[model samples]
Target: MGQDTKYIVGVDLGGTNIVSLLMNKRGEVLERDARLTLAKEGRERTISQITGSVSAVLEKGRELGISPDSLLGVGIGSPGPLNTKKGVIHFAPNLPGWREVPLVEILTQKLSMPVFLENDANAAALGEWWKGAGRNTSNLVLFTLGTGIGGGIIIDGEVFHGAWDTAAEVGHIIIHEEGLLCNCGTRGCLEAYASATGVVRRTVKAIKEGRETILTDWVQNRLEDITCELVYKAAQKGDKLCSWIVEETARYLGVGIASIVNILNPEVVILAGGMIKAKDLLFKPVREYAKRYALKDAIEGVSIVPAELGDDAGAIGAAATVLKRKGLL
Candidate 1:
């Protein structure tokens, strides 16, 4: 097969889902598959799901007249405190029983091809840099604001893996002193204030304190059922408490982004994940606060925008990792 006809597979492994894609050299996805991760079923079952998703995509590629021999390899974006150099998952909080698993080695053995691994957030950053909002920019920072916040930094078209391969941990940045507790056992972390979990947590506290808001009625007075999305929806209808929560969330994000902007001076700051659904309500204040707190010169010409690739960012970024390693992208 000619080099031009060769393809690559990208896999995004999450606790809830495993998404796989087959892509040609031109960065077009030719085939894709997704399946439940069933991570609670243990490591072996999760690995099976990963491999099965890969096989499904490859089979679809075959139907498209693509040969298995024309495939380059596979790259995975997995949740981590992992070692990319060793392709070992030191541990993943979301994927229980995945301590020091030699995932690349296992996948390479099972699939009979080269395999690579990267932190999912870093892969998403690369994906955005290559084809999404960060395209045409060499330095970019991405914040994935979901249940918890995840971050990825791209410097000079490369994922910035710091000394311990744990760089771009933007969520843990201290935004306040002795403030709200974070899941990571730290107080005042940005994730404690800016993530979806944070928004819901704060709103729940407010409601419990007898702060009046339509969110309680929206969630049928079941405070435990309240979600960040509900908070945003209520805010859209001019619910005072929910609007305050949204604004607070945006302010927290702004403070975090300001710190990032001051330090990295990235060309673009991209916000991804479920919280982006809040759209202007979240973004307008975030931009304002970021600009307010950031260095005047540094803030100039920087664009803070929503991520474009959405769910596909991780998978596409995983493929970019392989192409980058192979010097094809």
Candidate 2:
């Protein structure tokens, strides 16, 4: 493909969904599609599903009179502990039984084009850095506040994978050395308190311990249905317990962010993911706490903001990865 032809394809693969985007080299989306992952059929089937989705997008592009041969390439963002260098997924806790899958090779062979793989969180960060909130900033950190906290860091316009390809794992950063237990077998990691699951877990624990709260009445037998949105609504309705739950969660997130500030000193920090939908109910407290805890100079000129790309961040970042790989950016 000619350098100035300006066409790329990006894919975001999640435990429950697969989304694809056709974009110009400038990162603007021309077309997009999303479908359920249906991961129950196992790794190979899941891979096929991804391939099918990508094929569908290309077919759509053809219908739009966009030649598939003119496409730059494909980029994919997926759950991590992956080897970006080799485009191999070592083990994705989110995707059941997927071990050491050579995803890049699979997609490349199927598409007859170059394919790149990166952790989803990292891809989102790159997306933000390239065309969203992190625009004009080279040093940036992004935290995805979803089922579990996921993180990505960009230093000098490149994603930092660290020595173990898990360098920017801000979620695992221990905010409380003896606090909550994490799925990774660690205690007090930031994810255990700030993520959607974390907020619900804390609320449930508080209620179980006889803390007076309205959540007790609002929640039925099924605690799993109690989402971060429910908590935010309860807080907005002046439920003291719910308010406390959100505040405490924000405090933990802020402290965790402060630590990132101290360590990486990124120019911008962006929050993305489902929980960010709470709007100011969450961002205000997190900003306040960050101000209180982060170093004066570090927090002084640093920008902390919500991600602007929303659901498109991962796919956009995946597309940017193709640009980066091709030395276009």
Candidate 3:
């Protein structure tokens, strides 16, 4: 590597997997590595996995003739309720026994380089804003719709951490008062309706209540076998009950997005995660309902689109955090 060339490593830490990337300031990814997180094994094991991931990436960089000095640092996108300013993860529900872990300090000490941390969703939003669907806009909102909903807000080219670094908890936005209970122990949260888990939960409940659907037959009366993707497939096959569920999920998402639009007026709203695989089946209804509910001016010119980065967004965005902090992005 040239003396003037520099690089950074970004790690996306999840309960199931850890993805790490070696990237340059120019947004070029040079080497990538992935491994299981083994979160249930305990905090010490998970931390070792994280450090091992970084080491693997750095070793790969060495093989590419990249000097260790050219590597600036590592950035981690972690599940939180974390204190980014202090680099402490207060608690992570998915990671057993992860409480007040000084991750940045630990990783910095282990790697002998600066380490930065951000909420995973926020890192993904930064990734999209920098190189994915929201690349053209400085202000954006991103919703990752998987087992649960996660969100990030980007304002004027930066993640909006708000006063306490938890400003954009979009999933918990109350879309339906007195509605379904959410995993977060809240009532009527958007996550309780639109998330993949929420969708499957509602579907299973409706089936048990004797609502007719192809999903029941497909699952051979095993309601537990039904999934959000299976629900979408049934809906696409013209199952009336499944169709209604999909539409209801889309409407709930639209309602949430409309509320966000009214308040933030973001340039673009990007939807990511597994549910996006439904594509037009999901986007069409969501866009329509958002237009129906949002203030006319607020809805105008705001684009709701799918994210482009896919699985790589979290790691790329994590790296972007490092670059942004280093004044190199």
Flag the better candidate by TM-score, 2 or 3: 3
- Candidate 3: tens digits of C-alpha lDDT, residues 95-206: 9999999999988998899999999999999999998999979899999999889999999999999998888989999987899999888799999999999999999888
Model 3 quality (TM-score): 0.98
For candidate 1, lDDT tens digit of each residue in 105-204? 9999999989999999999999999989999999999999998899999998899999989999999999987999999898999999888889999999
After TM-score superposition, the amount by which residue 209's alpha carbon in candidate 3 deviates from its true location, in angstroms, is 2.3
Model 2 ranges off by over 4 Å: 220-224
Q: Candidate 3 clashing pairs?
A: none
Local error of candidate 1 at 195, Å? 0.8
Clashes of each: 0, 0, 0
Candidate 3 residues lying further than 4 Å off, grouped into runs, are 1-4
| lDDT winner, 2 or 3 | 3
lDDT of 2 by residue, 1-329 (tens): 56556689889998999999998887778888898888888988888888888888888888877897788899999997899989999998778988899999988998899999888999999999999999999899999988888899999999998886887888898988998899789898998888889988888888778777666567764666777888888998989989999899889989999999988889999999888888898889998899899998888788779999998899999999998988987
At residue 168, what lDDT does model 2 achieve?
81
TM per model? 0.98, 0.96, 0.98
Who is ahead in TM-score, 1 or 3?
A: 1
User: Candidate 1: deviation at residue 34, Å?
Assistant: 0.3
Model 3, position 143, has a per-residue lDDT of 97
lDDT (0-100) at residue 126 of candidate 2? 96
